[model samples]
Target: MELLPRRPDRLFPVLLRWMAIGMLSLLAHRLVFLFMYVFQAVRLEPELQDGAVASVLKALFVGLRFDLATLTIWIGPFALLLSLTAALYALPAARLRYRLLNSLFFHAQWIWLLWLHLVSVASTYNFSVNGKHLGWEFAAYFRDLPVLLAGSFVKDPVPTTMLALFIPVWVGAGFFVDRRLSVHAGAADGHPNPGRKALLTALLSPLVVLIAAVVLFRGGLQQNPLRPGDAMSESSPFLNNLKITGTYLIVHDLSDRGDFKTFYPPEENTAFVQRMLNDGRPFVDPQYPLLRRMEARRRMPGRFATIAGPGLPGRPDRQPNFVVLLMESWSAKFLESHGYSAEVAPNFNRLAHQGVLFENFYASGGRSANGLFSILTGIPDRAGRTILRSSRIFNRFGSLPLLLKKKGYQTLFVHGGDLHFDNLDTGLPHLGFDHLAGMKEMEDSGLYSRRWTMGFHDEDMYDMLLRKTDELYAGAPERPFFAMAFTSNNHHPFGLPDPSFAIFPESDPEAAFKNSYHYSDYALGKLIDIIRTKPYFQNTIILIVADHSHHANLDYLQDREIPLLVYAPSFFQPERRTDIAGQLDLLPTLLSLSGGDSPYAAMGRDLTVPAERPFAFFAGGSNTDIIGMMRDGFIYYHYLRSSQSILLKGTHPVDMRDMQAEQPQLAVELDAMTKHYYQFARSLEKENRIWPESISE
Candidate 1:
């Protein structure tokens, strides 16, 4: 008798075979990725050759985790669909027609897998060019696809051609492995009966596999997910980069792509942030002529010695509490402290007299984000971009808050405006701020105002600040707290907490801006008054500084000079410093006063220490293309948009002469230094060396 043909119930095994085949293909791609990375590392960072085999093994091991994450993301949905289809086909009433459907899906999966592997390889070439993996920044090229397509050949013809050639070869290799392992629906070993039990097993298996896939996708259940930063080893950046999977690097940075343009040589940029180097180490990068000169001058005898001794009665036995009041638009133009009239900021003038005042301090850039980045990270703002908000380097910088936290300080960042503004909400946390309170929290406490679009009025912020301070001190009285409070009332529209609070209210808008400045100062005075009454006042250090200056145009200063006051009655003596400083100097100065030797990096110097060549750098305007450098009783401005340099005679700035003709060397030096600073900053960002790699541990 002819036996009944056994039902083809091997769909589950075929699905399993497909999964195993896909994994093998993915593994092959990963090995190629590792090879490309190692090749690049040896070229860029020659030092990586030492223990090359060992480092590669370590990177490969680390890369496996990233690869698993990537594979799960790429294959998950398709796996689920295939598994479900197999289960459905294995039912008691299953049909042979299902084989056609399975074949269609199998082909689709093959095509998708091929595309993903090719794209992964292509991303490495891009990374090789810019030392960056694909991300939202890379996706941005799609908007200008024609330009990217056309320029790919013009800008990098050889690499583009090689990439084009390599893709097909890579995909072919994947296809070969896939074909060897794949088990299609045809000619499967027939089984007797695939009843409900067998069908249920096939269906439920996908869910079980899916759960495992999810665990792999997240790279284990850690508080922080595996990021590109985790790839960094103790080895060089290139070696660290070797461990970075293209997918992980790209996915992490896919959120926001702000205005970011890199305009610096990688080596020069790397050497520019010399803060990680020991003090005795020489920073002699010829590419950075300005830094070289500054380094040489600093090496002079008595140059780094204290310029002004501590004026306090006694130094603190422990680290003092730091209260940084980053006032909004607190321009020196409205303060008598910076030679402006006392009418607009009498309270500020009084505080200046009672504190250490930086007389010629300039803002790093026009925006608050620039000022915040400079003050916190001690890095100058990139010329044309918000470096803090736009770069992956945000997490890398040896931040003030992070260092302070190491020194047992509770780091807190309070802003009257929404912290989400300019991506500050996400950025500040990465910079190591432990607690962030913004407009919503401020409004919940009834400290917010609807009069201004910015957020809370100055007085309201101060009131809320006092309450927060009390709560913090009560929670941890012994632990020194480093609180940075950002005010927003003095921003655009220039509305005060109350009209009566304005000391210099005028009918004119500029005059009203001055009045708002006065109101901000008054609010500061209230906070100070409340602090003095509290027991924490004696050991507290209050640093009141501007996020950036208003366009008062009172002087011909090439940059916008803002008032910087360090009121540490227990540590600093009341003295006005004429040394040119900027927001970059703030963190270094504070660290010096705290007497903390935390291994940190900063672009600015400690003003309390003497330096031979003191200069203030600033770049502002619509595109932030106007770069300016102030030094040696003269100011130079380089307008990138116009490619013109202007040299002014004195502080008043009226006498403008052709920089090339009048002070050719000075103008050239300023222009080169500005470019060098920005380039170095950008390079640091690209290398992911903004913060020391060992910070997390």
Candidate 2:
């Protein structure tokens, strides 16, 4: 009996150990994902109650599947290496080398695990503030790492410290686990017929593991691979978002750039988009579908009527001086006028009473650059990389600033941050501005504060605006000016130079944000006071609007809703309009108000005139390829990848229930319209046809 004892199979133990290590790594990923889920659930406690619990649990299960897929894909190469090492272990001469390579591979796997953990942690904060996971857009922040890190540490030290400490602990834990695994692996016995058994095991084991990995990586035996859209739950966007892991998003984003796959013919897309934007008018050109001749809708009767401009024909009124204040992260939800209990925007509220406020106005996208692009070009943000950051930025457009410049107006663009930060320094000038000013200019004036990481405080930016306007006015008082001032203090890290503006206690969750909002409002009031004392105040038309809403716990539609105010007591009547409008409407609306009959191409209509049926189009930011349309008191969301659509009723409290089931036809129609809108814009930009070829660069 003692002579009949058989030796252990060497291949089986190696394969088992690999599987065990893989499972442990997967468990680690699951733990981090659960932590994020708990964080989100706690933050959105009020919203996720009752039946939402089951939906949340279902989403967690879906998330586990995605985590499995992500892990399998990531460890596929390591699995191959393990199989190779196992085959070599059959030879006594290669045994030592196999052990060394296996150990190295194990450590490499730990490094990858650490990376996944860090990205998941970062995504938690991103979701908390931006209502999204980490995607390719986050890569842009790496360019300004110093400022980003400084701001994070200054604003939220506790989380920053925790993240810093996580690295060493993770590494130490990896070492401990490796030591235990090493001991166990060493205690295993070798096979009787080493060479033949190891070779056979290597061949068969790799084939089995490869098939299993491929199945898991694809998320099942389904015809198609898993997609972010597959995780979407019609009942709860929060649950839908929860089902998507950061690793999946980052990898998906890198692999797919949301390129125009052309769902419909170019002609079909053009016709639909033209019909939507034509406003019952005829198209000017066969080649240019969006181009139309805009006629002035208003006549000015004032002292400035004596001044002449090309757009103002016989009436002979000077084009109104334009001062657009592109406020940063100014959510309508933070304003008293918008039913917010807080008096965080008293100054804006006061101005709203003296201006034509568009209550149903929404942003084109969820970023500053998106707002700027839409406001200037009258086009909604297209899917994929932002136009400002893409090579297509050089494409000529019928931008309002450029059109105004052609009408003998002096154009200037000023920002509170580094103009170079978002390529604004290069892109703004290329868009149309004759002059550009930013942090460098402010610093030269000695008003810049080093304490502010992004830029100087909002008050300092306001002062710079005043100074810049004065210079423009003094240089050519006869010429109307088109000046844009982009603010920065209301953004993340929410820093304030003056502590007096702190309205909430430090114990409050959004204390820093509330304080910054109050400070920006204070600056707005001061700027208005100074403007009222100037002579140009009588002729200047000032617009106060947000780049986008502050990303908070809300439905998708509500997140895009922002405040739009047109202030000029002498020109526009003080009225509150309930018509749906967006940042895209800014250019055409402003052109019509100023008595300009410029030939332009735009996707938006003049909001000054009432539309029998008005709608707004929005792109789900860089994180997702979702196109949305708000029409007929309902919002339609079309998820491109999974061909999924959601229709929601109402705005304030959007009914999260899927109305698409009851109204399938309407959903299909709206989905087609939204798709056409996005594809049309994308095609035009790519073809460099947004503007007529006659317009020279």
User: Which candidate tops TM-score?
Assistant: 2
Clashing pairs in 1: 269-680, 396-690, 396-691, 397-690, 397-691
Provide the clashing-pair count of each candidate structure: 5, 0
Model 2 steric clash pairs? none
Q: What are the runs in model 1 whose C-alpha is more than 4 Å off?
A: 1-121, 124-317, 391-393, 446-451, 502-509, 552-559, 621-623, 695-697
TM-score (all chains, Cα) for each model: 0.62, 0.64
Q: Each candidate: what lDDT?
A: 0.64, 0.71
Q: Could you tell me the TM-score of candidate 1?
A: 0.62
lDDT of 1 by residue, 344-458 (tens): 7778888888888878888888888889988998877755646544435434677788877876778888877876566666678778787888888887866455547777776
lDDT of 2: 0.71
Find the 10 residues in a row with the least total lDDT in model 1: 293-302
Query: lDDT by residue for model 2 over 1-697, one digit each (tens)?
Result: 0100011134445445545554554455445445545555656665566566676677677777776777665566676667667666656777556556766876786577566655655654555454556655355444644454455456556655566456546555545654434533343334324556556675566676678778877789864466554554233445655777666667665554564547799888888888788675577777777878766455444211211234454422356799999999888887776788657888898899888888999888888878899999987765555677543565668899888887778898888787755567666776789788898888887766654878777788888888888998998888888899998888988988867889889998877888898989889889988998998898888999999887866456668788998888886667888989999988887777667567888888787666898989888653457778888888888877777788988466667898998888878888888888888887787566788648532
Give the clash total for candidate 2. 0
